[model samples]
Target: MKANPISPTIPLDAEGVHHGHLRLPYSRDDSAWGSVMIPICIVRNGSGPTALLTGGNHGDEYEGPLALFDLARSLDARALSGTVIVVPAMNYPAFRVGTRTSPIDKNNMNRSFPGKSDGTVTQKIADYFHRELLPRADIVLDFHSGGKTLDFLPFCAGHLLPDKAQEAKVFAAVRAFGAPWSMQMTEIDAVGMYDTAAEEMGKVFVTTELGGGGTSRAETVRIARRGVDNLLKHAGILRGAPEILPTRWLEMPDGCFCFAEEDGMIETTVDLGEKVEAGSVVARIWPIGRTGSEPHEIKANISGILVARHFPGLVQSGDCASVVATMAD
Candidate 1:
């Protein structure tokens, strides 16, 4: 297949700000649908390694994209070396509608990696990114947050193996993030995931899950901004002293997946990152009726730290209730 046409690059002032767009094509029948492109603002000084910062891959996760917008507006790239390409809304269609997947394709852009040049809208966008943007990046930081119905504690996800030299860099990036929790993810390949593909290509990449559902959290945004600054310093793109974090890195020797035992309204009694012992009551499920029905108590299976919890109050039978990371003793 012929290479997709490169979008025009718009140059900004000497301060190192510019605007451009990425065009992703769908099918010929929907050619009139035109190219789906996102407005990207690039800022940097002389030619150096490029770092790509993108958000809104999952539309409902609002903070990352908004934070990228703030970074673009406030950054003075003239003082720094290397390029910073900021894509505030990667999934523009979903972002505009405050949804997680493209309304047209109903596909999660994050799951559609190395997309086809002439595939569905989501696939095209993914293909555009893989072909056009990713190859130029020396380091990538993909921002995300929990969707509308779920709340997530701030964390970083990256591969963790004993032998990879890049693992140190990944850990450093996560420590600089200063989030209380960091999850070591094993590499997987499917569609639309930037981290797995970046790893395969041997590029330095990390995915930051910053804050909970919806926007409105200043503290979360501030933390993310600080992380970006620290990463820039670490990369030698910026001249500054990076802040050291008091980080506690935990490994999950065994994970106990908590699934709902009955269909009912679920209520969590424990918070994320909380410690619980085996048989401890972590949640309760009860029928929605006003009349009191016996609430079923959900107990922990192992003594460990609760890493993830279902935020929605409603639960169905077999739905994941929580995940507990336990140390092997």
Candidate 2:
């Protein structure tokens, strides 16, 4: 089995502002010997905590990449107290094509963590992060949004980690980012996620779900930029206090979610951030072509705010229609 040929151009320990690439060798029909260079930027100053910021873990998501690209271009490396490694497009292939998974291997970068060095292109990229990047960082902020399939209210979130101390650190970072909502979340599955990998290593990890629908918004982008600055300050790598904002705390204790039972056209009555009660109808799925059949009502299992919902009109059986967030203590 051949190993991944991807390698970083910039030295991780190098000082000052430097723009480089993670060069991944490719053998395609157009250019057999050419390579795809995933852009990366590094800012370093003295001895301080390192922050690794990434966006575009799934190619369709744009807020992370947009915010990180600006930071890469605008931030001064000489003024920093520690290192900031910015990878705006973690899945460059998917990002280039505007899809959630890589076109080459159809692998989700977020689910390819602690990846195989001898695996597919997506896995290779994940392998590099797992082996070369994560070890050097004291904190990590991975940006995310709902992408094309769903929309989300702007929020910074942390998982319900087992390690009390690490969980506390992650919570602090989440609050520090200061979005309108702060989520203490539990995923349906965290087996191979990048978040799982980071949390497992006890790194202070924070992620965000800004506005979604496969595009960037002025407000979400602004939140991303402000959150990054706040995170750096909170980590003591930059000078200044974290920007204070009133954040509503939300939680998903058991990953309770609403799913469609039949394939049809969905009409969601509630919007993101709207409050709902348990057993209440959140959405109705109607017949796509025929109008005689009764619409199936999708109901919430618990009372909470509507944090995310399906964006597309059409849906398949078992597709997640909505997710609710309860107020957290």
By lDDT, the best candidate is 2
Candidate 1 Cα RMSD (Å): 3.5
Poorest lDDT segment (10 consecutive residues) of candidate 2:
1-10
TM-score, per-candidate, Cα-based: 0.86, 0.97
TM-score computed on alpha carbons, candidate 2: 0.97
Clashes of 1: 7
lDDT by residue (tens digit), candidate 1, 109-186: 988888777667777777777877788788888887767655656666666744478887787776666665666654
- Writing each residue's lDDT as its tens digit, candidate 2 over 266-307 gives 999888888898888999999877868899999899988899
In the predicted model 1, the residue pairs found to clash are 110-192, 111-191, 111-192, 112-191, 112-192, 113-191, 113-192
**Reference-based lDDT, residue 94, model 1:** 91
